[model samples]
Target: MKWAGEPLRPQDAPALVSKGLMLADSAPRGVVYLSVPLDDWPEPADDTAQALLLQRAVDGSPVVTPQTVETLVTALDRASDPALVLGPGADTEQGFQAAIALAERARLPVWVAPSAPRCPFPTRHRCHQGLLPTDAGSLAKILARYDTVVCFGAPVFRYHAPSTEDFFQPGTAVYAVTDDPDEAARAPFGRMFVGDASDALVRVSDAVTASDRPWPAPLTIAEADTSGPHFTAEAILDAVDRGTRDDDTVFSLEWTSAEMFRDRLTITRARSLFYSAAGGLGWGLPAAIGLKLGRPDRPVVCLLGDGSPHYTIAGLWTAARHKVPVTFVVCTNGKYRALEEFAEALDVPKGEYLHIPDLGILDIARGYGLEVHRAETLADLTEYLKKGPDAKGPRLVEILQR
Candidate 1:
């Protein structure tokens, strides 16, 4: 709140803003907020203010101390039956590649933590596994098979449901390598170390001898029959897979239900698959548009559920305005399907919390002035999606599945 001369003056606002920006830049990564008085709102922006706004700087990722790196390398060398969990910190291209290299060298099954903003590992790899579930009990059950769990760039655990079980069973060791010391400090039941994900991965890979254990087999996807009368979620995705073979299109899944079937779709690229690690909706459509704009050569596809797109459906207009060629496949089940499952799991009585029959997303997509297609049968869905990837403008295909 300190000012150059006095507080709350219109002239001092520029200096205050400048100082705030500087402080935000000089950080170990943090959220900084600047407060201005109500009287400051109507102030005029001069050349100095304009110049302040135009300044930009790049912050570099922090490096690990030699001592911490030694400790990590020693710990990894001793670990047998070690499993690696790649977290959100592995979002960068280098970090993702390093993780894969480390996993391959150590013969470890690489699991994507639920905190990841996108898939960090190639799903088609022998060591690659999908995301860890948010339930502590479920996560513990799966991790129980391993003697040691090594976490990178994410917390020891991020749970969505209440569970009495500990993150790991007795005698199972847990270790973490993260860039954030704050995260390392608060972590429960783990030997935490601080390091950049990519660097640490490389160091660990080099220090440890290649494991003699056999690499796990890659997951197999069962081809679904798309000749049925009604549209099933599996069939729709299979069709999308068939249609998108011409070009390597990045698929963004913001819809929660679609996330369940994500393993069905093969992700060969490191960062091509994206979703909200926090499990929030409304990011799919807009994210697809941004991806298209950033990489005009590659096509983008958004797989959104019936309820997910409503939060950011207006993104379609921006796509149309820019003529971004994104294929949006909306899975219309006519209800908040995830919540319905939640209710059933909790043993709650049947209620209307799961049902919403009035709204039509097709009409809404049409209102946004994008090409819309509704599919009642699998054949129809496949036919429309076959042309979806190469479509000139943004295309919306709504699959009516019960």
Candidate 2:
């Protein structure tokens, strides 16, 4: 075997690194924090210190801050209030708390401008309005009506001054708060405020009075289990919708669920969820495994595309080896639906060679000793998914898209 430093071939100096992971005692090239900011994250320069009162903005507290909480109390003491838009680039967790507090205090509607991910919430504080977007135009429309964007985790505005067509109604104030200086610096739309997101929220609570902007009501899905090729996607989604239990966690789409599954499945998200606004919730199979690992008692479901599952097929083996209980409900359309959509947009017929690998995911899952079920009809699919917990182990339910 080749020694650690030894070159594989002749005439070469000893290699300093192998496969990117460095040897012990080697300085870390960089640190990647999952969600929480790193303790060792480099301090900002003196010039950047103007944002924070202290010479150093060290605590990196994003979620809740004392100042924001105080602000919230003050706001609660009031009656009418301002419409709140938790803009991008703030400490999301603290911002979420602050938003919720403000909403409760005002006894009015509160909304997370762009997402529905459930994290950093006290288990009791899971109820809040997630914004609605039917299309690009709708997203812009909502952003337009608000006078101010109270950005916490995300930046205030994504404006292309080149075009006001997308801008929210002429001129709107965008204010931002976050623990991270980078977020404050990079916030494109609003005046940046630096502090714990919760603190910033508290500050907003202190400053603004309540407004009459109606908080979006909790999503009420009109469920229909219809049949036909025109309705297969909806039917399958209806089954997923009906089968979903509050105890079940869904990894909402990093995949291209929008192409086929979007209109069909009504996601009732309030708790135990992770989704992306980049519309990037991939048919997150491995992510589902990780979610299951973190919250083993909860049944994690990954609704993936045929293409997305291939990216992390190895994770299935890991699930089997560890006996991680997850149900991978693959929405198989036999073809790449996104690509097909593009084809239609370009007025191009799907090429004859637009073929997918013959991955019998059911057989593959069974090979790994997972309980695999394939449903041809809605009733069977619904029954299998609803009763998955009793299926003994990791389950993979395959439903044809027609």
Candidate 3:
């Protein structure tokens, strides 16, 4: 499906797609781009939403497609490969466990595509690549090689500037499965399977499995790239990965810096995830606050950028006034570095649009009565973060970057 606008919960697109696809028993072959919320569990549905659900589900299935166990049952039967590309989308820790249960039943290696980029669950799923940091070429390879690329809950035509070093393969079959009709209508890459991603995924897997066809060989786990300088982006993520605890919640605002973090970070068993998929700056800090408000017990950290801060500096005051104890780590790059990377990928010089520094966020955080900390290296950054909750805080840490 085609997804635009601020952002939708990672679950909504997939939930919509998976249901739609199962409604089509022939099964669709394409990519799915699931969009998830930056915060935990979906925001509670409003009364208007309740009315919408009731109106749609007068008898269910034709519309309300019961968020059922049966959908997954079908996926186990249909899967052509012994692995599942489980991504973000779908509410309910209960629903997640259900999907995992089915993955185990089929002995499928499950990897998360990370509806949001700040996830290392790729490694957890035993996937060698972190969100498959390949360019259009590499993605096309994955897309073409699969006899049936059943993407549950994602959009078509993913556009990334430095997405991968590889090139796009044309004419490869692509499919998008999403719950939202607008998402389905917008999909450009492949035919869409509209409905709940979780359910459609389950149904397709079950259908493929029941077919008893020879499943594709499991994708080989990529060996560690121990090449020179170890300059790969994942290396940076690896450097900071050890600092996170399983229980800690992660909120990142810098999308470019995300490669290092997502490629390297380790997700614990009980973890919460958030990020601005809309690529909007400044949402990071507010998102951290939102995540905290949604799950106040966990340590929530917002990894930020200079360009993005201006969009939401007021978030500091709100966090302070509300007494939400979120940790803010500003990766002190000068400006919109992610945009710069995009320009380079397009073979253009840095845009005139970039090249502006901001009033140091540190002073502003302190002005708002937050505990401000500064770190120039990983060691220092880790130490400041370890200081734990401050009675007078929402702590802010500025980590000087090259």
TM-score of 3: 0.68
Where does model 1 exceed 4 Å of error? 1-60, 222-227, 376-383, 386-389
Best by lDDT: 1
Question: Which candidate order results from sorting by TM-score in descending order?
Answer: 1, 3, 2
Against the correct fold, how does model 2 do in TM-score? 0.65
Winning model by TM-score = 1
Q: What is the lDDT of residue 156 in candidate 1?
A: 77
lDDT for each residue of candidate 1 in 239-346, tens digit (9 for 90 to 100): 777666643678888767656567666666556777775677788889899888888887788888888787887898898888888989888777888777777778
TM-score of 1: 0.84
| Candidate 2 local lDDT, 172-249, one digit each (tens) | 555555555664677545566565555566566555555444554543435564764433665666777567644444
Q: Which ten residues in a row have the lowest lDDT in candidate 1?
A: 1-10
- Give the local distance difference test score of model 3: 0.54
For model 1, what is the error of residue 76's alpha carbon versus the real structure, in angstroms, after optimal superposition? 3.0
Q: After superposing candidate 2 on the true structure, give the runs of residues whose Cα lies further than 4 Å from its correct spot.
A: 1-82, 86-98, 107-138, 157-164, 198-225, 229-234, 248-252, 259-271, 276-283, 342-358, 390-392
TM for every model, in the order presented, reads 0.84, 0.65, 0.68
Cα lDDT of model 3 by residue, 153-193, tens digit: 45554445455444446544445456667667876555665
**Clash count of each predicted structure:** 0, 29, 69
